[model samples]
Target chain A: MTLLAKNITLSYHQYEIINNLDLEINPNEITAIIGPNGCGKSTLLRGLTGLLMPAEGEVTLDGKPLQQWSKKTLAKQIAILPQNPSAPEGLTVKQLVEHGRFAHQGLFSKPTLEDAEVVDWAMQQTSVIDYQARLFNTLSGGERQRAWIALALAQKAKILFLDEPTTFLDIGHQLEVMELLKELNQLHNIGIVMVLHDINQAGNYANRLIAMKQGSIVADGKALEIITSELMKTLFNANTKIINYQHNGHQKSYCIPVGI
Target chain B: MKTRTILRGPKTNKRFYISVFALAITLVLSLFFSQIIGAAKVNITDFYDFFMAPNESAAQKIIGNLRMPRAIIGMFVGAHFAIAGLLLQAVLRNPLADPTIFGVSSGASLAVIASIFLISAIMPTTTFLTSADIPIFYVPFIAFFGALLATFLVFWLSWEDGNVNPKRMALGGVILGSIMTSAVMAIIVGFGQAKAELAIIWMAGSLYGRSYNNLIPLLPWSFICVIATLAIIKPLSVLRFDDDIAQSMGLNVKLWRMVAILISVGFAASAVSVVGPVGFVGLIIPHLAKLLIGGQMFKLIIVSALLGALLIVLGDLIGRSILVPLEVPIGAITSLIGVPIFLIILQKSGWKLK
Candidate 1:
């Protein structure tokens, strides 16, 4: 399904955060948005996922305007996991994941077999099946993050959007989450879009990288073409060295911010 | 491969079922014991005779008229307060949220007391207990509007930017409740000495001398709100997650939040209007239920209702029987038991609302 944002402007209480932005999200690629703080990366994600209503333009999924589609139908095509989300105390991983099927089930109807299977599939995919019985509060940060991803996966949405999914995670867990997203995109053809803090992680993992500054896209292209020192200096006012490398027979680039 | 059902929630062992069964039995036993344990010196034979024998004794009259209605009211009020607390906790995403703590009950109490004072003032000759003078049935309805108003006030006070902060909500609720309570007392004092005792007793939340007039107004609210809470269990559970996550999970967070607030306020208002402010049932019963049944919404709601009913009936029974002739208010008993446990829970609780 094609998700398109046409000249959308998002604001909170008349103070605009994203101004007249247009974006087209490919349904089968991993897109990483890299930007500094207060650059509207998260706001744009919310606007595209129907979380934030744009004041100016419209977001459409599969040619239907987001406002016209019922929330459940829109949710069937797109799912979003907000940054640093929390669950209720004593909620177990499985129960938390089962909440993803809310749009699929009737108000009073019990969860069907298909819903249960999908939840299981999601947990298994995230490798959190073993922790299904564990309370969310008791899990390690990485496990909790995976459980949240499982919850999003359980929604069975073709496009998944996450805001800084790797924040508060360790280096290994961060890589684990990035690898999982890449695997989901490659195997399941699920569109993955995330706001990433680490530019190197974004360049290493994402098929397409979108760089932003002051609520506008400054660069949108392949990671190799977009990870130049000039772009880093312009976006973040930081001096950086870019190194080209090869991993698994693929060209990859990682950058390091230099002092002075 | 064994398939897991969401009906059972995340994890259900023998312990959860046993706890629910035990609570249900306790509720039934309390209901029975409440009928015979009051000041009138009645026994099991008296209870059986009241139901079975044709000729009615003085004790049978007491059972039929006084104890029976009181017990029934206690049961419904307990269920109402517990469910109200449960719904409020979920809606606010705060472990400490409840009708009494959040000022919903205080608002209802204010509305009730103000309306009563207005009615009495309009008919200056009419006394407080005169059944013919006052429109008793409209009390719950009036209290509902009052509760809705208070809920709005608290939400408005706690709202920041686009979200609510739990700390601000708790503090705001406390301040609003104190203000409304002082106003209620001022109205009570305005009535002078003759009617003050009855109003005081009612405010203290005694089920003493409550009858069908109180029960009838509360029945529909208790039934409808409980059923409505169950009907929206999915959205209610989803709502406990972060607002953005809840919205993405396909819940219209604002709409469902309003529905939860209304249902919860209905429970608190109906019960408060009928029995004055029965504090702590709405505060502690949901936490007690969570301790027993975990936080799965369906089981938590069901067990909370049962536990609430048990606490109220037992509290009422203890309040009346423990002092023979002099009655301790049910509210007093609940507070005496609740405050200590609440402190302990607070000290040990690890949940956060952000």
Candidate 2:
């Protein structure tokens, strides 16, 4: 259930997006991809999801080339939740989540008992069961984001990719989503690779932090070891103050960027 | 029963019931009134008797041959346009997208006009010495080819680098549709006497000379298109989300999008081939159906199809009877009637495009 991208080079209209990038994701860890704006964080995530083909290099999942795997087969193992996904009007939370079961369903198959069970489980895990009947458009931004996360969970994927999942979310909802990710990683052993805008959140939540600068990995290690002032200054071109604290007996690190 | 239980949701349930009620009322009223109100009015009781057991009366012959076929043709054509419109709206994710917006109707119309009016005139002595003995079945075939060609052109123009951008598709369709319609208009104006009657009939989208032969050829293709649509309802719903999300969920987005376009083209073309380009039914009916029933593609498809059928049948009936001996075009009637209702619904719903 590991994903490996080897020397991946990606470009759009002759402009290089990801240049000779290589990264490896372990089976059971929360890995966060962080970089300054236009530094190819989202581009790398897209490359991993097969949405954008690499100009050169190979992406392998479980030691098999991603291109060789059928779309459905790949989807079964990996689910992606894009930032600010547009939902159809009048779609309920349950209905939206049920769509995640598409890969598992046959051409003529109706939603089976197992499918329902999975959807229900996903909704419960995301704490969206209470709003299962609510129209997606009617929900608040935070709730809506959770509902989309639930949809990804419903896929029952062993690996998940989230593109800036908490960008527009409030601090409370951000923690909620992060905590859910941590629980999912710990309990289900699902590998999570996400693009995060907030360096503090990435430091707090992710087990492994991969910082990209100019389409290449500048730092990739355990969050605490790589989130130092020098690495932050180099990656973001800004001075940063590191604060260490204990939260509910768990050690945590926080970064405050100067001249933000 | 089990499926109904699983499908239960307050909004979905309410919409489903309302759609069922509206469709039932529309179907009955349209069918009953369509048979009764023609050039020569017949009693409702007489119309029923004619259908059950026909007597050798002119009223019976007119009811059986003219009005009934007209209504049936209207329903089919209406359903086709409406469903096509609905699919287009969903696929494009644009509220304003419809069969006409995409130029499928115009493309088909151009093909038909060329085959029916221009081709026959240019090669007058090639096949049959006289136009009277020419096979009537040939008209729809030519129209079908026209529709297919138009759709192919639209697809070619809009598709770029494996992406079918909605805006590009609509723009391409509009340009192509305009050119084709101009050609149709030019042909009609250039050959006034020889093609006037046929052109008028096609424009009005009448059911005057339709036989079982017309319905037979179109039925199978239409059914196939509709069934294909039904099969893809789940994928369409998934597509309603972001394309990246849908792709990650294992959908072959490009292939499915192409299939959807083909279905829309097939149904729209088939309808045009049978009847002329009946406007507004496809544009307005799907929106109305969405209002009555929420945006579940499965339910939306059926309700839109039924509502479309209802609108056209009623519109055709009104056209046939309102002016008595001089029948108005069903296309004109649909636009006149449907546009206002659509606007009213749009106003009520605050024109929210979701």
TM-score winner among the candidates? Answer: 1
What range of 10 consecutive residues in model 1 chain A has the weakest lDDT sum? Answer: A128-137
- lDDT (Cα, tens digit) per residue for candidate 2, span A154-258: 888898899999988889988988999999899888889999999989988898999999988999988778888998888888899998889999788899877
Distance (Å) between predicted and true CA of B61, model 2? 1.5
As a whole number from 0 to 100, the lDDT of residue B103 in candidate 1 is 88
lDDT of 1 by residue, B1-354 (tens): 354443244346565789888988888898898877877788899889887884568888888889889898998899999999989889888888888888899899899878877776766643553354367778889999998998889889999766666678888998999899998899889873566788888888878778888798788888799789989998999989888899898888888988998999999999998788888888888888777767788888888888888898999989988898999999899999889988777777754444
TM-score of chain B of each: 0.93, 0.88
Alpha carbon lDDT of each predicted model: 0.87, 0.80
Q: Give one digit per residue, the lDDT tens place, for model 1 in A34-144.
A: 998999999999999988889999999889889898888778888999999878877778888999998898897888999989999999899988768777789999999
Question: Which digits, one per residue and each the tens of the lDDT, describe model 2 over residues B257-317?
Answer: 7778778778888888777787877788877877677777788888888988888887777
> Candidate 2's interface RMSD, please?
2.6
Q: Can you give the lDDT of residue A109 in candidate 2?
A: 89
- Model 1 CA deviation exceeding 4 Å by range: B1-13, B124-130, B158-171, B352-354
